[model samples]
Target: MALVPMETALQRLLEDVGPLDGESVPLKDAYDRVLAESIVALRTQPPFDASAMDGYAMQGADAQTTDGELAVIGEVAAGSTFSGSVEAGQCVRIFTGAPLPAGTDTVVIQENVDRPADGVIRLREPTAAGRNVRRAGLDFTTGDLLVEKGHLMRASALSLAASANHARLKVVKRPLVAIIATGDELCLPGSELGPGQIISSNSYGIAAAARAVGADVLDLGIAPDREDAISALVKQAVAAGADVIVTSGGASVGDHDLVHKVLTREGMTLDFWRIAMRPGKPLMFGRMDNIRCLGLPGNPVASLVCSQLFLKPLLARLGGRTFHQDIRTATLGAPVSANDHRQDYVRAAIEERDGQLIATPFGVQDSSMLRTMAASGGLVIRAPFQPASEIGDPCQLMMIG
Candidate 1:
């Protein structure tokens, strides 16, 4: 079979995938969720003209001249309304947020006024109309669109939604991913390793990647190199309503590789296998009914690289979120050899020096070297069939972390 190119594999993996159905959630629980529908204001903000400062409300005409003395007819605070109207030489002492008096069009701040006698105040400075007053509907009017659909809710968005009188919000449902690790030579972390047994570490990184794209994860634990064990876990994933099922290892043609056989027997229509990429050439993708399945390589670095390249984007689309690769151009800090038929993603350390990005690839790029992959700052992309290059050559880099 011809190896699928990376771009073609990604396109097929994300084909026709869309956000899940909407569900209502309380305002406090809506943070970081994608809005399913646009939020419209139910009531206008500052429904009535109100004071913006602690001051005296009076007719604008009466405060146009300096040394203007006006009798305090009454007082009003926040949530309180003045009963009588204000006339010339008459004012109402008002606090912030109090409704403007019926006949008053301006407020002289307390700092700019003087209380010379009881029930009487003098304007120390001339004031203009509408000063220190918030007009009706100043922030937003009723029926105004405040937040559009597909927007990710943040702190400001939640506050705006609350101010728009929305106690609950319709948000896209988070995608659920089920992860399974396969192999008889694998054991959980912190366990005494028997002969030929290594700790299973890919699930942790894969789960974190899924969550970074807003997908929930269910770790199905380790499955021995047996068809029955693997098949049982696959069935459990389906019964758990997983939107995507991710399996680590057992994707190649080796004797112990049973993921491919089990998935096909379970009625998964194989989409593609063996991508034209280094380190992760044995990658596989398929679908079973409504659930998508991905078979990743056993090597730790290969699994993580494939997850960042493919799984993240697929989950982002299914969760109604946007994802973009942080690709950058950089100069190679060391010489590199020519590429083969497979595209290469060489792990490297990247630094910014003298206004230019310098990428230095590690000496050994073994896919099983998890420490090197963890320390890598980025991946230097090498196109297939490319010629050999030397230091200072321009290259494309995909930033990690």
Candidate 2:
């Protein structure tokens, strides 16, 4: 019976929630997945001291002078090793990635050496000891931690894991969200509209929002306003192993609102219903066993706004990621009259003037108008029972675009 505060509802929705179970996937398919466990290097990088450039490997002391000369003993290319050791006055032609000869401590680049004869080479410039040489385990050694748990596997992380000899990775399982739209007057998009009927668009937007937060979505399509039809889909969502079930419409107290009755019968314990926010006051949240159920309003704008405000964060938490709202401070560009019992989230057009953000709310903010919601850059928050405000007053803003 009472409207729940926005903050309290969010806290309840996320209470005790955490990352899902881990699943092993191939390295190629692990991109963008969160690591479930830390990755340790199995083998050392540059297992042996190797050459970093095409050069001649010899003792550093032997090539200290510009006139230094040494007899070419052997040639070592990448993926090949020199059997003989380098002795004084002797050098080996070594290509990039070739292991350093046993007795060599440095590599004189080819540009700094001139071939005086078929086997004799003269040094034009001296190279430092260990120059142009990659020491063993230069990048990482065995047992080194390559990546930590909960890290997102980006391109760089994937490459690092591969270099650490990891063929597969343990990643967090993406949370699955099952969506059901309930209404007698709702039809899928591109369908011929009957009298008093409208196209079903909330599920599409809700599904997209769910996916943007690392959730896998299963759209169960529209269910007519009947207890059996709604309950059947709810069972399907549970059978499909959905972590969360989202229902649009049938949440209010109207005669046709049957979601509450069916969900309670299906073992969902109502946590809270009705938020102290405009456009989305009819929001509902509950739980059945391990599955979370969120009943959103029927209006398109309300559905989208509630998704951005609540659903994204809940899904992100379940997927082993953190989500933060982009809230900022701005000045109201136009005067606004405000005084109400419910908090208002007035969608506004944002612009930057003289390095300050200016938020101008659209003239009409009907919950059914989707075009205005799409054109808004952010929402200007107004507290309940607040006084009328003039232009240039300070306001809190939540950026949506």
Candidate 3:
């Protein structure tokens, strides 16, 4: 099969993907979840005209000037109301958030009133009608939409929803991705490695990538380089109702590569097998019914780069969130050789100098070197068949940091 262009592969992978079904969750647990339904106000904010400050509430005309003394008819605090109305030349001692007594149109802040006697106060400043008062439905009226669908629940959204009297929220279900590592030579970290064995590290990075896009992860541990071993894990992922199954290693055409054959045998329809990109050329994508199956390259750096390039966006879409790679323009800090036919994603150190971004690629960009990938802040993109470039040349970068 021919290698697929990077753009073509991405388009095919995300062609029909969409947000999952909605599930109701408590408001406390809704933070960072995408809303499946717009949040509507169940009750009006400041359901009644209320005081916005600690002051004396009276008719605005009653305290137009500082000379007149008004009799304090009663006192009202937040959560309590005065049963009687304020007559002419009368005021109520009201605290912040207290409901305005009948016949009162304004509040003279305590700072602007002087209490000459227990029942009399003289205004130092004139408060206009509705001044220091929160009118009924001041923030939002009942049935008004406060947050739109597809919005992410952040601190402000949660607070607004709670103020609108919402105890529960409808949010898109977070996508679940089941990950499997396949290779006889791969072992868990901290294991006493047999000769030629290496630590299985891809699943950790892949899981982190999945979570950063709001997808829940299920690691199925390491599967040996055998079809039956891989098939069992694949079936487990299906049984667990995972929306996506990510398999690390076994994507290439080598004899030990069994992921493609096993997934196809398990009823997955191969969407694509190889990509026209450096390090991640063996990338595989398929579908088994509703589940998306992605086979990433075995090399550690390739696995992580592919995860950043592909898995994040897929999971973000499934979780009802928007995602875009942090690609930017930068000048090369050093000279770079010409690229091959395949597109290149060179790991580089990114720094800003004199308001311009500079990307200096590492000397060796071998796919197997995880240390270089970790140390690099971004990937400098080189299009296919681009000529050799010199220092200060303009280039596009996909920022990772």
Candidate 4:
């Protein structure tokens, strides 16, 4: 079968992904969750026209001259209301957030005023109407949509909603991603390993990627390369209410590769297998009972790259958050060879000189190596079957964080 193009595979994967179900959560826990619906203000901010400064609230005309003196009819602090009207040359001593008494149109800050006697203060600076005042609904009025649907609840957004009188918010449910590692030659990390065996490491990276997008993960542990063993774990992930199940290793054409067959036997309708990309050729995508099942190659680098290219965006979309690759153009600092049928994602170190991005790929391009991939800040994108290029040639790159 012809390998699927990277863009086409992504499009197909996204088409079957639906936004997560909605749930109501307390405002405190709603931060970083995607809003499921628009949040309207429950009540007007400030509730009434109030003083914004801790000083005398009086008519602007009376506070224009430094010699102006006004008898403080009464004092109003925050949460206190004064109903009596203040006439010309008479001011009310009001604290910040206090409701502006009737007939008060301006405020003179305490620093700009002088008091020579009890309840008697003189203006030392000019004040203007509406100065140091927060009018009713200045921040948000009743029935006003403060946070729109599909918005990722950032710190500022969450605080804004809370200030608008929202004690709770409706947010999309976080999808549960289940990760399973397959290989008889794998052992859990921190355990003593025998010859021909290695520590299973795919779940940790896959789960972290899912969590970066706010998705929950149910790590199903290791499933050795046995039909019954793999099937049992698949059933376990489904029973745990996982929205997506991912298996790393056993995806290639080797005799030990059994992920594709296992998923199909478990009722997964195969969408596509084998993407046209270096370090991730054996990547497989499918669905089973509406739950996504991704089969990623055993190579550690392949698994991580697939998680970044496919898993992150899939989870982000379902969580109602926007996702995009940070692709940029750069000049090659070293010569590069031609590609074959698969597109190349050469791990490279990037630097900027005079604001020009320069990409330098490591000497070795082995997909199984992790040391070089870790030192890389981005991947230099090379199209499939492209010709060789010399140093200083322009190319596109996708930044990784």
Write down the TM-score of every candidate.
0.97, 0.96, 0.99, 0.96
Q: What would you estimate as the lDDT of candidate 1?
A: 0.94
In model 3, which range of ten residues has the least summed lDDT?
59-68
Q: Model 4, 128: alpha-carbon shift in Å?
A: 2.0
Query: For candidate 2, lDDT tens digit of each residue in 291-322?
Result: 99999999999999999988999999999987
> Which number leads on TM-score?
3
Candidate 4 local lDDT, 1-401, one digit each (tens): 89999989999999957788899999999988999999898889979989888999988778777765789999999988997999988998899999999998888899998888997887777777679999988887889888789998989998889888788899999999999999999999898989999988778889999999999999889999898999999999899888899999998898988888888998999999999999899999999987999998888888889999999999999898899989999999999999898888999998999999999998898877888888998999989999998999999999984
Please report, in order, the local distance difference test score of every candidate based on alpha carbons. Answer: 0.94, 0.94, 0.94, 0.90
lDDT tens digits, residue span 130-187, model 1 = 7889999999999999999999999999999999899999999999999999999999
**Model 2 backbone overlap count:** 0
lDDT of 4 at 5: 95
* Top candidate, metric lDDT: 3
| Clash count in backbone of candidate 1 | 0
Q: Of 2 and 4, which scores higher on lDDT?
A: 2
For model 3, residues 1-401, the per-residue Cα lDDT tens digits are 99999999999999999999999999999999999999999999989999999999999887677777999989999999999988989999999999999999899999998888889999887777778899999999999999999999999999999999999999999999999999999989999999999999999999999999999999999999989999999999999999999999999989999999999999999999999999899999999999999999999999999999899999999999999999999999989999988999999998999999999999999999998899898999999999999999999999998
Q: Which segments of model 3 are wrong by more than 4 Å?
A: none
> What lDDT is reached at residue 79 by model 3?
96
